[model samples]
Target chain A: SQTIHQWPATLVQPVGSPLSLECTVEGTSNPNLYWYRQAAGRGLQLLFYSVGIGQISSEVPQNLSASRPQDRQFILSSKKLLLSDSGFYLCAWTGGYNSPLHFGNGTRLTVT
Target chain B: TQLLEQSPQFLSIQEGENLTVYCNSSSVFSSLQWYRQEPGEGPVLLVTVVTGGEVKKLKRLTFQFGDARKDSSLHITAAQPGDTGLYLCAGAFYNQGGKLIFGQGTELSVKP
Candidate 1:
């Protein structure tokens, strides 16, 4: 079975602070990884996606960035956080095209 | 941009009642997926419909993919309180690797 692990699960940071959220998948190799943010409790905005190591496609222009260091390890980072950056962050993985995505528990970040 | 619009942005219904949620799009999709998210957790994959006019049933939940692959519907029979959560519909393009377009999401609240 495939499982995705994401952390810190919850985060509270000050404005202009750096941010790092990690996601890893087990039982799969070279899977497609995605980063998404949900605000106002509905819908999700795609942040980034990776099909292989060292390759990342950013979906939106924002302060946040994503990287896939290893085949199953993905990281979402930001040099400086904004008040609008706070939301529910989710990490998901899929086998390939037309495959259903499996998501991690998610991280709730609050920027104060 | 290819967008998926979900109707009835919010739904509140009594237990044992039936409800339907629709996802519409002007663009064609190779596949459509349904997900359910609980509070404080990531969205979980409920089902995926690939072929046009395909219908899949999972317990009391019934999902249908439109003939043109431009829409989908989810009908829940004898809804229970446990079914209360956010429902999301995602569509995938043909051979698009892992890129998925998400709908605005439907918040369903079933009162027991």
Candidate 2:
């Protein structure tokens, strides 16, 4: 079975502070990873996706950035957090094109 | 950018009631997926419909993909309280590097 782990399940940070959310998957290799942000009533937006290590495609150009350091490890980072950056951040993985995405528990970030 | 639009942004129904949610798009998709997300968790893939006019069933939930591959629907039969969650629809344009675009989502509350 595949499992994804996301840490700092809940985060509260001051405005302009740095933010780092990590996610990793187990039981799969060379899987495509994605970063999504679900804002209040705004739907789930694709922030970034990576088909392989160091191959990240950003969907929305914002203060946030994503990196795939290892095959199954994806990190979402922000050098300076904004009030609008707070949302439910999700990490997902899939095997191939058009495959079903499996998601992690998610990180609830609150930038105050 | 390819986009998905979901109807009934919010739904509140009784436990024994039946409801239907829709996902519509102007562009055709190679595959469409339905996901359910709980309050503090990532969206979980409920079903993926690949073929045109394909229908898939999971317990009391039935998913149908439009023949044109531009839409999909989710029907819940005799919904239960446990079925309450945010329903999201995502589509994959296989030829477009398989990036998944998501709908705004429907927040369903099945009251008991």
- Of the candidates shown, which would achieve the greatest DockQ relative to the real structure? 1
lDDT for model 1: 0.93
Taking the tens digit of each residue's C-alpha lDDT, what string does model 1 give over A1-112? Answer: 8899999999999999999999999998989999999997898888899989999999889999999989999999999999999999999999988888889999999999
Cα lDDT of model 2 by residue, B61-90, tens digit: 999999999999999999999998899999
Residue B37 of model 1 has an lDDT of 89
Candidate 1, residues B1-112: lDDT per residue as tens digits? 7889998899999999999999999888989999998888988889999889999999999999999999999999999999999999999876555598789999999998
Question: For candidate 2, what is the TM-score?
Answer: 0.96
Each model's chain A TM-score: 0.98, 0.96
Q: What is the Å distance of residue A52 in model 2 from its true position?
A: 0.7
lDDT (C-alpha) at residue A98 in model 1: 86
Candidate 2 C-alpha error for residue A86, in Å = 0.6
- CAPRI tier for the interface of model 1: high
DockQ of 1: 0.82
Model 2: what is its DockQ? Answer: 0.75
Give the range of the ten consecutive residues with the poorest summed lDDT in model 2 chain B. B92-101
Best by TM-score: 1
Predicted structure 1: clash tally: 0
